[model samples]
Target chain A: MTDIKTLETASSPEKLNRVVIEPVTRVEGHGKVTLLLDDNNQVQQARLHIVEFRGFEKFIQGRPYWELPVLVQRLCGICPVSHHLAAAKAVDQLVGVDQLTPTAEKVRRLMHYGQTLQSHALHFFHLSSPDLLFGYDDAVAHRNIIGVLQDYPETAKQGVLLRKYGQEVIRLTAGKRIHGTGAIPGGVNKNLNQKEREFLLQDIDQMIEWGKTALELSISLFEKNLPNSRDFATNETNMLSLCREDGGLDIYHGGLRARRPDGSLIIDGIDYRDYEDYIHEQVKPWTYMKFPYLVAQGREEGTYRVGPLARINNCDFIDTPLAEKARLHFRAFADEGLVQSTLAYHWARMIELLHCTEAIRDLLNDPDISGTELITKGNMREKGIGVIEAPRGSLFHHYEIDEGGLVTRANLIVSTTNNNRAMNESIRRVAIDELNGRELTEPLLNQIEVAIRAYDPCLSCATHALGKMPLEVQLVDAEGHTVDRLYKNANGDVSLCKIEA
Target chain B: MIRHFTLDGKKIPFREGQTIMEAAQDAGIYIPHLCYNPEFVPHGSCRVCTVKANGRIVASCTTPATEEMQVENETEELQGNRRELLQMLFVEGNHVCPGCEKSGACQLQAVAYYTGMLAPEFTYFYPMRTVDSSHPDVAIDYNRCILCELCVRASRDEDGKNIFSIDGRGINTHLTVNSASGKLGDTDFDVHDKAAQVCPVGAILPKHEGYNIPIGQRLYDRKPISVVGDVADHQEE
Candidate 1:
């Protein structure tokens, strides 16, 4: 860590002349963005590197088939429930159970919605809310969760409570907030008790109102800064998500649906179990993460945006009335075209948050949640694939089991990995548009982060873990001499350091 | 007339040849023991049942219940030592409770909880162990073996199969099958063998039975191990 005195002597917020930026805030896990510049200060190349490596795929081998669901939760702390449920679905196939009992399905769905609600609430209020509530160019010190709590206490309070409510739902359904063993092979192990159902029902209405309030806040903020955000980090890319049989937005279970930037279907109603037939992961030597693209479009053009933006853009309609209305308005705002603005991710996320609340309420009202039937037994299968729309984007869990019921192979394409190329493109656009031929400023550096933050990538879950990831930035001339360097420790404190020639 | 021993300030009546654990069990006092099944001869291999007898730490299951003996079982210092003992047992084996089908029902996990061992303090051994699933009706997951020798005792004394034994000594110590092929499937041991049901952990599991009991409904889920006791203790009159 660079000392305060050394940092003060080297540079300050008012006069940041270095090319590097601070570590990204509000995102899960560690990542780095590098922009290669020419002598003319032109952005030559931009890349988002996943620096951590947790080889979960290799480690999960030889484990019992029944343990897959719980074991996979070790992949991500932010969205363990998503991984848990995905693995559960895959193990369900391994058990040769095509469908879960109504009670089991509803319990799992309720758990997933709670996960989506809490995850989105956390990212919106705690992580990205600070940047949005305070202008992007606001003082770095005052542009964080603490800053939001001090200035917008009511909004922050709602965010905390909404997140708490979601976690409570998870606890009652899944057994714990994180690394829960709720979902098991073939089906869930337990059903929602009447008491648990009522406990969640008590807050459904307030959570819905808060969800709407958050949606409104995001919309107003986006609209207020329409001009600046419209083209900021905007890249017209293809989008992908899971949609119901009737093309309704279904985050938990559905066939794969993908669309071009023009709202034309690239692929629709394809089984996600056959995902490898259409999708291929392209490996680059620079990072641990793999870039996934459509097989037909190839790597460069096939790279698509996912998560809130993609799900909202690709789905025909949202099932919930309130979220459907909001989705319609969102479409109207986009002139019935896909919303290409990166900043619109916040809006789409809140819209889904509202949808999750409605879905949660509906599920709680259903008597099946309290039904006794929880598990289904069937013949065992060899290969199993499970896909779900995680809080970030589409997540896939594929596994192969031996005759004796031990996992032989495991392959996981986490949500963030699907958006790898899109995140790089977002950073590239920001660097080209904002930082070209200019001295590095704190706010300009933050613009690069804001673009990537829109996708809400969990790099830890995507590439895996390695403790703290300190963000570092370096600049070199055409001849590649160390011109300048900046460093941001894990605490998000940025300091300029002189590279001794 | 019954002789008595003072255990943690409580007068525990005992028979002449009874061990402290036997006396404790008879008096409705639960002393956490993994390898001391009352159905077989007691082998104090696992030190989880260590109690202070006359100011000296000793295995309560093997120590004879002497008249006018003073024993301290539930002191804070004893509990802490027991926690350390349980932690060693945890770190020494690949006891992934979440992944194990026997998690909720296993006496090892139950006793660990009763002793307040939330997380292991020692560095994980991560020792490479075997899983013998060749048996049609039973499987042996050596990774979860605690070297308690309950299966060894149960097979020899009750089942009369002599199908299991401990192989290595010290840190390398592990349960070994007595078959020529060194696999449970090759042995004459059946799923109905007393050895099959005697493992304190997930070491010996019946094939095709995976998580039969839901987590909340498992043996120790509703109550701590002290209240429920081990299967042998529960079966004992």
Candidate 2:
């Protein structure tokens, strides 16, 4: 829950000064945090502004419907496979395919699990681990991956190997690691060959062990910090994700499930195609990104969280044994309610990583994965929608095609966009908690970034149009006098570069 | 005796009535081309095979090889011009290679690579184009059409069915089907027709059979187009 009383006192009607952190590092795309402060340096407001727009939705129009799967891969370099699969699922509907063959489904699942494994491993290990291992307040020079490598070589090596193993799974399943042409309109293009299966199996056990080790490391770090970690940037927001018919954690495909902070179901087992009936996007004037909320809850109370933390909170139970055990441990952190701490995202992400490894191992052993029956045909539909749980959160891709099989319109609500409001809330909470009546320093700036990094938002995937991002910081009083200033360019070079006239 | 022409300062022999491309192909020389298939009468719509003949620019596919003529095939200036032409072709239409099934096997992409055209210099037109998938087996994507007229020539001359034609002019010039409804589904075109298999780009394709071959194993993936030498021609019915 938000501290409305404290917020009201801090947020005076007087115009507050601003502190801008342009180009938050260790994340996917271009974004900045603007913290408004009063004359006493008390934080008044904070917002995560998405400064870049990639107009993928508009540009993809007029393309052939079948090309959507491949074309959407240009959306994000980090999670292109997620986009690839989601668009493929949507295209399947246009071609009239209600269901795919057993072989095709299994192959797609393998690819999705492999993608999740790689994406989760990337966020937890390479990007956010420095803040978790070396305290968030550590010197800027000593709080990077390089510093972690010099200090804890073994941990860094495990992170690299874990990410590499996931990438290998993607390469074998999709044909290429980055922009794979595996999943197609109605099904997958190919199946795992016997040789490919053998290769993946060679190190499947090692991957599982690494997953477990990573989960344990995250658990130890979170538990050691205890109350401090639990209280850091905590907020009570709704959670949303996909769950299997049996109510197990499902990343690839399932019915929609959203839960309130008090563990009450807002919506359950609803077909994701009807998501527009429940979810609506609210436009804000300040940023290009749109804020999505539950239509029933309206704008203010409707905003919710997604991604690992939300998925873990929303699922009834995880299917894998190891992951189920880890989930139970994670859920118990909040006792009678859902875990609302932003920092707990890393823990929940590791649990999913462990599950991905187990799922990959099981998929590799399945005989259906090698079967050649790959495609299916159905009655054509004019409109189609596909939704999946990407690494960041729930991703939706909807398209309308004319009789000629050409795309007339495209609407994509990416995972990062779903968390737009939640990210802003997290930043505001961190700013008020860490920066009130304090001197502005690099570590304080990093704390705000650490809160935003928890969601692992991809700004490039979130935006729907083109915009310029000018990076500069100025502390101006109510009288409009510049008290201080800082600047960061696109190349990440920081200096006292003067503002353009 | 065959007529002799010095191409790139090397003497090459050509028979009477043979064009410069024919002479190069017959003499074990490779000249990059898209609209000039050896099996068809020369239709020099795509000037990818342009060369310097006696210090004057000419389309080699249609230009007859002359005795004692100096023709420069692989000069730096010609290659540079060819790259610019390829870049123009790229930006003139929506030719997204990664999404197109013909990516690894596309001759246009290969020729661009052979000419060292790394990126399209011009802004993409992104013209609104229609895809005609009304046909049961074959589909045409107007966006990828490079106005080569290879399919038009192949259908009219070889298949004996004038099924496709170039309509409009300049940027509006587009491939149109000769049918009652302006659709391929209403046409007499068959999968085995010469026009169906003659598209040098991804303009025309067979349905339900795209991306079947893995990327690395496609026709142009294993070897550059300079070595493959129009192997995609007649490889399928």
Candidate 3:
């Protein structure tokens, strides 16, 4: 974006300023976007304030090691599978199992593909489609999945059915859709039945076709929104994701890879368990989420973007045949492997969606998917590490167990936190470029939300580290008498006067 | 002699001295209940089975089957109150279901499922409780205990062993063991004790039997808890 260079120096971490937009919708958890405007109406800084405290990291301390896999799944309703697998991977190490029974790994991989597919379908059709199909300047209420149903009825239905299919896959593999405990340490708890496998396979051909169509539609939408993408909140930053041993795209398991904006390699093929050696976490006073930066680039400048765009950029190729074709088309949009258009995330998201379906089809076709030998018994270890490419981005869960097998310490670097700094940068860039001296309309303010939504952040999971412990505010006049007062309830209901107040 | 009463607009027949719960059970109607086992003396501690008898709230397990009495069990108002009580029990203890071995089989969880209780209405207490794994054949996880006192009643009335009792009151109440060492292992409570099989929550579990059945194939898994036992027979009409 032309404004990206000018907005680079706008954010100063020292000072805090106030312009609040609360209850950002269509994404998970409680969050507010705050922008600090200078006297000249120029954007000085912007920040995403995630306020909810889950207390999982703190409360999970004394739980037994075997329980971590199932216990951690409650972190997020939408992305429980990610947490489930990540925690399972970590527990696998704790169980002293280098690898799982073949059937267990295959079943887990199949279940993971379902999770990725379902999440992408939800974002594209249910959340982002309304903004793309109906246009952003449309009425706020009408720019949702319901509006998409009214206009593009078939597309909306397809989105719903696709999500349902993905959910069914999860239910078939795991016990139930939300917080299922099928994925255990060393292996899964059960195997897929032939009847269930047949049922899922029946829809594969149609799902693949729908994936192609949705990806094509998303690419067309991106071209139409290219001007907006180029101008609005285009963040130029480093990229990070997980890649297969041969540098292929891997959503389930792989080695870590980071690339700079100039297509130079920051690090490649690094074991994610050794993440502390190469990555550093920086905390800000304003938000509960932490910013993760590369150790090589240092704090402020080391911030990198993750999720769909980053995954597509950091990987060399997609292993699935049809997905590889889509990847080739996506690569053309980049200039020497550097695509800075923040909006291109939607395009990359579609490619990943295609990849997920193909991956699911491939995993299900493998005969070993239905094999038993689900669990492996082993000696326990004190420390464990697990990492995987979550639908959002790379997720890591590290834990230490006591002699009694109770979890002593747990550290989670969730996907949303990895992109925290980049998300803020996008918001600041958009506010500076678009909101300069203009009366902030609903549509104009929505750009900041749109910029944040592109990351598909799950704030509830990210806010576990530290949170906005109940705050109250009172304004005093020059004479020191109280003029105004504000406070939040336990459920975070602020008695703010309605719009036009 | 046979006597009859009206429950939720249905005629239910009963014998003398039988409580409303017993009559309802005889008539193949399921009234949501816990801590009211037929084999043991009625210990109406869990309040989840409170129903309206003749326009007044009463525990059905203790209320006698009266002639032509109007008893309300499935009213939205009553169910709503039941849901609140269930929610209170959920938050009162550290009931972490995913970590529990008895999650799918727990009657408290099943009752919550039957009452459509999605989440606890109040904040989670996250109480730190001890696990008595000292017993060779049985273990007691105090976190999932709902303080129903069924184990205490079953141990004294059925098992003929005075190993379990209720101690303290109000929020400080807990299950107390009678042995000098205050552990299940030190007591005469065996794996075959009636008290061992009577716990509705995951409080007292048989050792070496964790996750014996996968989640989807458990007791509450096949038919939802609402359709289990007396609850299922009542759904036929």
Candidate 4:
């Protein structure tokens, strides 16, 4: 958890003279970083500050209990389904509806997998590929979807097609792709038909084939760049994920587990309802987002990462054959134990994508995919918690309701919040090691942004609706005199780039 | 005789045999709708005014008002259905929204625009259809018609013309001219009629004023039309 403090001149004379990177760039959401330096220009304290204020918690109060799923689903476009499912689970819990029938469970799992596959695929191919495949300083035009198509048309086409499959799965199961209407308190409202099942199966087969080829291409690219890419593997952080006791792949649903770099599970079967016990949230003066850290380890050593790398590290075995093959290849390079580096996360995401595709295929081919028993009737009475391993990390939704079925209380802890401590640590480490001796250039800035994006942080998901981030940087002299200052507007356009001796 | 029920937790009286929509309107709680007209017999085809009755969501336009029943308007499930229905309407129609002359005035576009539908979730079918410039004063573009049956309703109930009818099913179901000749000009259709003006999308555009009102100042330009209102008082019977 972050410790908020007001900077005082008398406390540390040397610290008064520092340079701060007020705003970070190339990210979806707004955040800042204060880099303190001594009189000798050496680094002092590096603090990553998230400076966006959104009150989704406060906004959702007094809303009808049943409406939460749709309301929360709009929280983030990238992970709308995650929020929807979590909200539904919470409602289900409040309604005292647990243990969905096999068919309903299978359909829910299918929908969940669709989101995971699409979201993970999007991050790997569109978001992260620019840094890994193309250089960080690649032109803006060449850094987006158009660029991907131009550079690798087949790969780009496959990515689009694969995403379509994932989206189609969501559409078929939920009735619509974005902000779907399927998952209710008891179960889903929509059911799949025979034609829809067949369509999904055919699409899944194509996606699986596409995923296999994409994996091979990605591995080859990584292999060719391994020696040069070694330095990218900088930050050493702890890993947290949801996994089974036997250490098999658990993505859609599972219990929480925390582990060190050596594959030793420190905390296992941590009930999501009791999440507040293991994780602690603290407020920073600059940002409304609460930084949550692992309580047992404390903030300094409590820095732990979640998402694909974390999941790969915590699990001993994978369910799918294709995923196991990818895992073997990944382990050959980074070892089988808990790998702490953020760069390895990309590989983990690819492995998971492969696994998700295979799993989706398996689920689609099941006879129950077209079952009529989709929604189960139930009454709302008891509070419940819904925990799922979203593509980015662990997602938890807890809700309390009155007997009348109106939501009295709702608490959501997204995966990105869980990685806040680790992200700060990673940023600091990269700043110290990569930026210490290097000149402040556009490439260096891009590298810094890439390091943060490596975790695939969903900033929009983190901060609900506080708009436009303003970035201000200040360089101070030994006497605490402002030597240089820079200001950037909400669109990340530098408004003032000035320097004073 | 009147039917009474709770709406959004408030109790109100509805006409004995009136639709839930009519009752809600009589109670001054406007339910968002597109197809239902007070003059027409309830069609319940659009599925936009779907509300929870006895814990199950159903179209309020067709469901009869019942005594002491609980009805939830604008519930999460209903909202989802409404949004999805709007999305389907947007994608299914040839509503080239930005360029349409009746964009603001069109009821289909009005409901969609008010609902905050920025993008269509489903893939655009982009079905093409020929515009019938057959009528002297009006043109019917089947592409942008959402099959809301508003035109059909107006023809049969309001104008007492019965010149419009719907054909097909599911996603393919669409409004067709009620003439064996299959042409608006060939049929006993008059462009000056209210049915022509009541056509929701640019599907039924005025032939003379094709590009007169810029898309922005169209149907919903001045104020939004209430879906349900005093329908009990305006009852045909």
Candidate 5:
């Protein structure tokens, strides 16, 4: 990861200008970024710092594994399903339940897809839409759900419907929206009935149609507003995702596939069980969250992206017809099927919504959905890994167990954290492009926020914050080497250099 | 004496220590529950039962039948009671039902509509109470408390810790953290305690979560509790 330092400017410059963006607002959790500009007013180096700690993994050590789905779900409400499913999948792996019958798989997939739809809808409509539809210069108060509703009632209603449909799917499958109990080791506890299946099918059809309209509206709005055509895009050769043998769109279940921007699949069909072989987590003292990178590729060059944009970019084809059409439309915006701009995540998410709906419809219509024998019994034996594509990105849940099937060790790689490196890069690029030589207006700052929100990053899942009050940020320069540091107390402050080091 | 019934066309037997819901799970016939935990004593406050024992709608959690009896859990009248009971629970407390963390996983909220509870006919009694943040990890906000007793029971029975007790009486009777300081942090209580994890309402919240999961994705945001059914069935195979 430190190899990027070669790209850093020499600190021996006669003078340097330092710009600090502190406590980026409207986001759920706390994060900060500091940019060091040379006397020439060009961004010399950028550092992203997450400043909070709650210790979720540590807290869950002695607790019963059964409580994990509910407990971990509280990690982040934005993507509770990611934690819920991760916990369930981990427990399942620990228990060595291999045979996930068709019904159980369908139910789990439905719940997973439901979360993806709702989370993506929230990101595209409520969070990022304000900048695209109403412009970032709008007042802060009017830049939320209310503004979106008042400005674009039709779009807002579609968002509400789309989100509602997803929530309903989750509820039906899991018993509640946020932290449900349906997901278990062998199979989901809940099974869809004919009536519920019909309802979901009908709702999914409507969502697909509504999603198309929303996509058209988004494209028109983007075209009309035409967010500055600056080259805020980064083509980091490291891109990783879950893919099938045929390289089709794989979300709920697949193997890890690392590919280059040039479309060559490097590590295809990486057994999730052997995740430790390719990925390793680095713990920084400054943040409670751990940064994971492709071990084989090494840190600096292994700057892979995830979520809708990465998934779309890496996939060979989308299965559902309507979604395939939207995928094609998305491809039209990118060069060589690579969407480098973070702003395109919205479009990619919208396409994913359609695909989820279509995929859900297919799953619901499957004859095996209502089967009685959902769970396949198995005794605790070997360690295993469960990988699924969370709404935000690829989620990996790995567990090791003793003879009794109790989890001895668990390592979770959430979707949000998977995109952390890319998110930091995206934020740095957008900040440099938007803030360089420009007045620090609220609108311009909001635009930078808009770019970050484009990834729909869940900072809470990234960093667990207990009752500790939010921290303050400071910008300091050691000679010409500028550093951004966040402090809980003045004496205990950790420098930005430590992060890169 | 063992009790027997036909649930969803399958005949199942119930043991002495088992509630109808537990018996159903053991027999592979899931019955929905919100306040009844095998780890804790059953609190049949939600009344989500269409259970007809000898031709009368009774709360299955509290009802113990004798001899060979016919019970109808899927009837319209039983569904009506379940719905009405849900409405009562909703209106009695500060169940902003939509924004609650337990919305999706909440038994009370989901069972209400699953049994055809369309709207609350009664007036909502939004009580005001203080948030007991004395504990470092757990938070207890009495306002959102539904008097489910899951916390009280779990604290006493499962953890063998009587750290929580009910104060006042009737509608005024609310769960109080059993510490001299009256704050969660002041007590030995942590989120890992059964008292904290078993809260069916948003009354007891973990300090770590705030705006992490949005309101839309909260528990009970999806289908009703009847669908998720019993917890015993969710155990690892």
Candidate 6:
């Protein structure tokens, strides 16, 4: 078991001097990290600022309840399946179906597994590998996928192949890999074909093996980069994920579970619709991202995390045999009941990947996966709520329909949005630790980025909106003035182009 | 006498007073369109079917087909313009195709496929269009409306209820119902009405049968927009 000790300090936002990394890179959305320092360059405040604005809430009014599933998925291409499924669950209540057909349920589950697998692979290889492989403080240009390829060509190929397998799973289950139209309001539009099944089945064993390989790789990373994995930032307050009644790793349909930093269950297996009873959202003026916390807990104190790390920590058991074994090893890493090291999120992701692949393999062997009955229709209702575990976190889609069954009001708490407070806190802590009153350098700035990246913070998805992101990090003085800025040039090098502006 | 016009290098014969769209349809060629339904009086609101004739752009559904016209229907330049028009439609409204029930059959999505425009080139407006689900059988999603006017024309000319009409100007132009309340249930627009059947987008949808047809088996999924007849020929009911 990993040793337990309080090896880090949290962020203290007191005075005004600031350092900023504008338009943060290697993350999904537009954001910046601002560090407030004292006169002696002592760290005071570190904040992750979300700059992009999207008014999805203002616009989606007056759409039909049945359209909610299709509309809300437009939030993020990276994890549209999560949004699509969550909204579909909400719409299912409006459609008046108590439960879906067995086949419909399995197909949806398959799609979810595919989504989780692909998204996890993407974070591990495409985004975070450069930092882990080349070292966070290495040359910015060499700390990316290209660098991974240059240093470890075979490893890069395996990453691409692993992602490709996941994509194929999506393409076979849904119509297209990204933004697929497979799941509808009541159930799904189609079921898997024998050919599609065979296509996935042929590669199932290989995928499981690759998943094991990936898991080993991730464990090695945590073992090697212990400081980066443990020390810099700790957003260990509380965690939330979905778990089955038996405490199995249930990603699609399950009750919500919330755990304390020690990994003891505060609440387990509660209906998702009751989320408001326990959690509340607090909006801050500095950023569009809202901080959701344990009800009445207040801002920083109420901070909790979602996503892979939380999911791994909160769950009691894994349903699948192989994944259960991997889960055991991951659990052993915890000194107490939870692993507070932000970098351990990468390890958590690999465990989920193993589970996803194993789950996919088992789901295929079941004959019911190809059933023809894909939808169930019933009397329409006026109000419905849907919740599902997205790759980033727990997602909720609630809609109120008129007598005509059209949506009058919609409120969505996306996965990333659930962790806004935690992400901000994590990035802040990382920034303060890496910058002990020194000038902002590429390596120091990257430490903060790695902290944010640990959450795989999908700001675009979290904002309930979507767009392209170009991020920059900067240094600021006492009166809130820009000292310097770091930008990613065309060659992927972090270039500080402008100064003293 | 046979009057011939070469469209995309194909000799397509046209009858007098017939628009380019009608001629192309008769010749088994699909010029991607959204608003120009054969049943309604041609209202070229959605310029998705715009074609270039003699170096000048014209709405194929409204412009009369003349003899021996050199029409550029399936060319790179015209298709590029059509892609932009589709992009404008996409960015202006909340046409979330992947989540839409009509995604597999939507004319906008189909034409987008036919034009090879994989994704929109502009920013999404993420309009907060309202959905009118107050009706018992049918629902109206304003976000998916391309302002094609097909619903308006069908409701007015065919159903004779005048339940729908054009309500705004310029980019603000929108579709509105004639009911005392803005809800669809308050209006006489039933699921069987031409207005409901005439929608080329997912804006107007039939309730309860959302995922009846599997996506890959849906109309546009099996055949491209170029092969299937226009929106009118592929009505769900």
Using TM-score as the measure, which candidate wins? 1
Residue B192, model 5: lDDT of 70
Using lDDT as the measure, name the better of candidate 1 and candidate 4: 1
Cα deviation of A424, candidate 2, in Å: 1.6
DockQ of 2: 0.48
TM-score ranking from best candidate downward: 1, 2, 6, 3, 4, 5
DockQ of predictions, in order shown:
0.44, 0.48, 0.21, 0.02, 0.03, 0.49
Q: How well does candidate 3 score on lDDT at residue B81?
A: 89
Residue range B10-72, candidate 2, lDDT tens digits: 999999999999999888888999988877888887899999999899999999999998999
Q: Write the per-residue lDDT of candidate 1 for residues B1-237, one digit (tens) a residue.
A: 799999999999999999999999899898887888888887887888999998889999999999999999998898898888889889999988866777778888888889888878899999998777777778888999888888888899889999988887778887888988897777788877778777778888876556545556778889998898785453222
Tens digit per residue, CA lDDT, model 3, A352-391: 8888888888878888898978887777789898998888
Off by over 4 Å in 3: A1-18, A225-231, A461-501, B1-101, B111-139, B148-165, B177-198, B206-215, B224-237
lDDT of 6 by residue, B1-237 (tens): 779888988999988889999999999888888888887678876788899987789999999888888899888888899999989989999876666788778888988999998988899988767766677778777888888888888888888888888887887888888878876688777788888887888888877566567556788878887887666686753
In the order shown, what is each candidate's alpha-carbon RMSD? Answer: 5.5, 3.7, 6.6, 18.0, 14.2, 5.0
After superposing candidate 5, which stretches have Cα over 4 Å from the reference? A1-22, A26-28, A36-42, A221-230, A233-235, A283-288, A403-405, A462-501, B1-237
| Candidate 5 chain A weakest ten by summed lDDT | A489-498
What DockQ would you assign to candidate 4? 0.02
Candidate 4: give the clashing pairs: A95-A380, B104-B218, B104-B219, B104-B220, B105-B218, B105-B219, B105-B220
Q: What lDDT score is found at residue A364 in candidate 3? A: 83
Off by over 4 Å in 6: A1-16, A225-228, A296-302, A462-472, A479-488, A494-501, B1-101, B108-131, B141-184, B208-214
Candidate 2's C-alpha runs over 4 A off are A1-14, A462-472, A487-501, B1-16, B26-28, B52-58, B66-72, B75-77, B122-139, B159-161, B167-192, B207-210, B231-237
**lDDT tens readout by residue for model 5, A206-305:** 8878878877776676566444522443435466788877878877777788877666666888877788888887765544566788887787666688
Candidates sorted on DockQ, descending: 6, 2, 1, 3, 5, 4
Model 5 error, position A396 (Å):
1.8
Model 6: interface root-mean-square deviation in Å: 2.4
Q: Ten residues in a row with the worst lDDT in model 2 chain A?
A: A462-471
Docking class of predicted structure 5: incorrect
